[model samples]
Target: MALRAVVRSLSELCITVGVLIVLFVVYLLYWTGLRADSASDDEIARLHKQWAAGPVDGGAPGGGTPEETGGSPSRGQDTTGDGQAGGTAERGAAPGTARGTAPGGYRSGNSFAVMYIPRFGGGWSKPVLENTGKQTLRKGLGHYTRSAPLGAKGNFAVAGHRRTYGDPFKDFPRLRPGDPVVVTDGDTWYTYTIVARPYRTLPSDTGVLDAVPAPVDEAATPFDRPGRYLTLTTCDPEWGSSHRLIAWGRLDATQSASEGKPDALTR
Candidate 1:
């Protein structure tokens, strides 16, 4: 009789532990994602509101209009793949030209831009916030603070999660060369074109964020000269972080805030 009680107690304990583990998994994979999605949406909305209010200090006004539905961009206001605009684009002191905290400098943990990838779908938009801290990533994509400014002369690197936290980079591996990754700081729209397939490397490979990124694992980088570039990174394997997957791009175009939307975003 005593032996039977011992076996029953052990079984009950095992069941309890299993239930706890399942609940934790659900929280990480489902509940956390829901919360992160909501947070990201809120950040995007906040950025739009700030832009509508104009420049924060004496800086250039937040220029881009809120995301719109089907409508043709005004004639002569479209941007090409070579960072040129057709019409007279507002090339005033846009924040994309600033490298520090002036009128549009990025603040730690605060969002200053919105990123859109056509390949990610028409409705896909994510807030690009400063800093890749643990908590900041829970809200949306994080910008590597040390990288170059938006559309600036060096590497502009950003990081996002592969799974959970809304899985912003869940499709990181699907991106291909020539894909357009567009970003807007409300003042200027910068479009970058993917130059190579995703490169997989260990988490310690920090050279990938350099001004002229060095080779990874002796693998040659597509960039041959010093130019404005964009680097997106996420965890590999879809479910773990033992390795990072990187996507490299070069600045291809820019549009004014007054411009409705860049071609990469409109079509």
Candidate 2:
């Protein structure tokens, strides 16, 4: 009887494993559509040129014309600047060497340089840019809809997973005040300083990705929550995404070339 019971237990385990593998394959198939591999050389150069020219208001890279999606956090001015700070949540860590955040956050179709958190490790090297067509989840930093362009004005919000899907925000818990976060437009590298790591509710009913952050603790700063605030959001509890983890960083404006770990060819 004991042997029979043991055999049955092993059989059940095998079945469960098989089911998991099949589900995983399906997930990969769905996620495959999210990648951008067929970019044209001309398009790449154009995006690079835009980044070199500094922030532009006449539609971002591949922004089509201009969108008017309402996303003003405070001013109610349809903020969210024109840039790619997309989102798509994945649970498991991505396979292979991680790519550094590049073309950083372009306006879809338009390539933008992405500054990654090298200190944050492989999981954070490349941030998954999201699109506006789907439900926003912060799997990666989302680009601004229209109006507030990258390096221009408005809030440049971004999101990531803290414990799964490579867990970009794994070190988010350790990010101290004044940590550096650089964003390049190919030519100029914009800098951001870590400020705070706060939290909000699920789905973020409010305009969490606004032109600027909602007054947290009534802290005062230049430009009225001004300059650029790099908002990073992730799941809470670290096990399951029960709540959301939010953090804010201010743009330094003064940009320089990026020279750090994760050299070229790592991409």
Candidate 3:
């Protein structure tokens, strides 16, 4: 009878252990994602508030607007000889030739810009924090520090999780060539056109973050001059990080935030 009792107690212990394991899995998969979403929302709200407040003359924390800084239009604006509004001109620098300058130097975990992918959905947008570290990615997409600044003449690369955390790039695989990936620095909307299909590479590959992402396929070409480019990197295979998937794009247009949402964002 004593031996039987010992076997029954062991079975109960096993059952308890199994239950705790399941609960831990649930916490990692669901609770962490909820936490990430809440953090991202808070960061975005803070950025909007800063932009709404407008910048201080030359000493503002977020920097001044293009007009105040003597910079060109964030996006191309068209006007006839009489200064009346004309339709958007071809995607190029405006007469004064100013592009969206970096907001200011940001710390590792601070959000500096917002990203919108119309291909994902009209409502799809994410905060872009300054660093690619684990903590920054958990809050939102992480901008690679060595890459170009947003709306500038080099590869503006960013990284995000594919499945866990908020799964910011869960739909990354659905992006196709010609799709629009738009970014805003609170003052301007910079639209990028996806140049080709996503290609897979080893996680160790850093060329994907080059000034012009090295051509992966026939669709890509090396850019000799300074040109606005973008590169998105995420883990492949949905649930693992054995490799990375990359998508490339080039700036197609720029518009003022005062003009309202860009056509890529509209229905």
Candidate 4:
């Protein structure tokens, strides 16, 4: 009788452990994603509301001067909130300027733009927040602080999560050359065409954020000259960050927000 009792207790304990593990997995995979998705949507809506209200203090329609908006760090510094300090490109244009105008500032942790990838589907859009910190990425895609502004003449790099935090870039592997990644700063719509499929590299390969990312090999060279570019980065293996995945693109076109949505988004 004692042996049977012992066996029964062990069985109950094993079952309890199994149940707890399942709940943890659900929280990580489902609950966290739901929360992140809602947060991203809220950020997008906030940006739209700000834009509709018009530019304040002569800044971009939805932006303000860095002093007023709590701007990010200057160029060549670690604005990503990550420990690395590598980017050397020119500072991003002040927030809220049309193409060809002087660069504006970015309020760290704030959403300055919205990105839509038709390849990801018409319903897919994510807020592009400043600073690629751990907490910033949980809200949406995080822009590399020192990279160029949208449609600017330098590398405009952004990062997102692959498996959690709403899995914004879970489809990172599906992106291909010729795909379109459209972004808007409430004043202009910038369309970028993917120059090649995703590139995988070590997390230490900060050159990918340079004014012009160096080609990994002779045959895979994407850009050889300075120009406006787009880069999307995420973790590899869907559930692991052992490697970094990247996608590069060039500014294909730009249209004023007054002109209606870009064709890349309409079609």
Candidate 5:
């Protein structure tokens, strides 16, 4: 009789432990997402406050004098090469007015820019923080430290969580070729078009962050030489990190923030 009782007690203990393990996984998957959403909201609020207070010294690099619209200097022009002349505005300088210098040194938690993807829906945007560390990514997208700054003649790469931490790139797979990925640094809006379908690779494949991402297929290089490029990265399978999904884009047009939001944001 004692042997039977002992066996029953062990079985009960095993079931309790199993239940607790399941709960922990649920917390990591769901609770962490709540925390991340709250963090992202706070960071975006901070960035807007900064913009409203006027441009910060050593703000984003690559700003230049305002562009000429008609007879006077305007905030910015639609340099998209599509012949759509953006009207003048009372605020912000034009693209290329500020030279592309080294971006100011920022710590891990600082919010630097706002990224918009039209294909993600008209209201989709996320705060881009300085570093791609555990803490920073929980707030929003994390910029790769070694990559080029926005609108520069190199690759500006960023990473975000696919399944947790606000899941900033949750719909990454929905992006199609020719989709627009727009980013603004308070002064200018840089628009990049998706060059091709997203590619998948092992987590160790760091070449996706290269200045010019090497061609994945034999359909010619996306951009022949080193020009402004943007790369978005996230983990594959929505819940696993064994592989990575990458999206590539090239700078297509630029406008001043003062000219109003880009069409990507409006549509």
Candidate 6:
């Protein structure tokens, strides 16, 4: 009888701990989701206030400068050579700009303002300035620390939770070939088109998302160059993140603020 009583008490304790963990998670989601929508001046202002107010190099800087990062054979060059869009990583372009490095345009403090995914049905999230940090990745928009600025000549990567914090990519798989993903700063919007689905690659598949992402099917080599690509990742289970699911896209069109951005594009 004593053993039975102890077992029941332990079970009750376990349940209590589980409940507390869930509550903590709920709070985390609330804070992160609040910022995932489209980037707005008001949003920026608030973030600036939270960040203690100062100009931040928009996008993520952990990935390094556009030219210094994401330029290896792993990224794969434009095998198609269509020329409509080669590749971009120009500095100062905006958050989530093209991966191909575009020299000479980069300036600091506000590269990307917003991110658009029609898969999410026009509702987008604002791009935030960040550096590679454990806290940043856990929140949303992990800076590459070693990559270029957003829209610079290299890749600037961001990460978010798959099940919590509104799970920004909850519907990301809905993106089809030629579907568009747009990122906008205050003045211009850079566009990307869905080219590939998330394929499992070794963590070494760095060049593609690196200086360039390497071909998933091929070995790492510069000549294996494919084209500029964007890899969107999230936890696979939908309910829990165990393995990662990645979605790929290619650069498409760019628009100025006057062009009328898509409806539901911003937060």
Scored by TM-score, the top model is 1
Collision count of model 1 = 2
Backbone clashes in candidate 2 total: 21
Worst 10 residues of 1 by lDDT: 68-77
- Model 6, 50-127: lDDT tens per residue? 232111232144455432443222122221132323223333233333432333222222222456677767445544
> Each candidate: what lDDT?
0.77, 0.47, 0.75, 0.78, 0.73, 0.49
Worst 10 residues of 3 by lDDT: 73-82
By descending lDDT, how would the candidates be arranged? Answer: 4, 1, 3, 5, 6, 2
Clash number for candidate 3:
2
Tens digits of lDDT, candidate 2, 1-267? 999999999999999999999987765444422432122233344444544343243245433322221111111111123343422111012211111222222334223345566446543444324333323322334444432444555666665546533344667677666666766545346677777545544654335566665533344222355565676666676766677666667776544444433232143
Candidate 4 residue pairs in backbone clash: 60-96, 93-103, 93-104, 94-103, 94-104, 94-105, 95-104, 95-105
In terms of lDDT, model 4 sits at 0.78
The superposed Cα distance between candidate 2 and the true structure at residue 175, in angstroms, equals 1.6
lDDT winner between 1 and 2, please give it: 1
lDDT of 5 at 165: 71
By descending TM-score, how would the candidates be arranged? Answer: 1, 4, 3, 5, 6, 2
Locate the minimum summed-lDDT window of 10 residues in model 6. Answer: 71-80
Give TM per candidate: 0.81, 0.52, 0.79, 0.79, 0.78, 0.57
Q: Per-residue CA lDDT of candidate 5, range 1-267, in tens?
A: 999999999999999999999998888788888998887787677667555544433233335322222212221222212232332232133323342224433334566688989887777789887779887888899999888888888899999999877677889999888999999877689999998777887787787788987744435346678889999999998889888988899999999888998887677
What lDDT is reached at residue 166 by model 4?
93
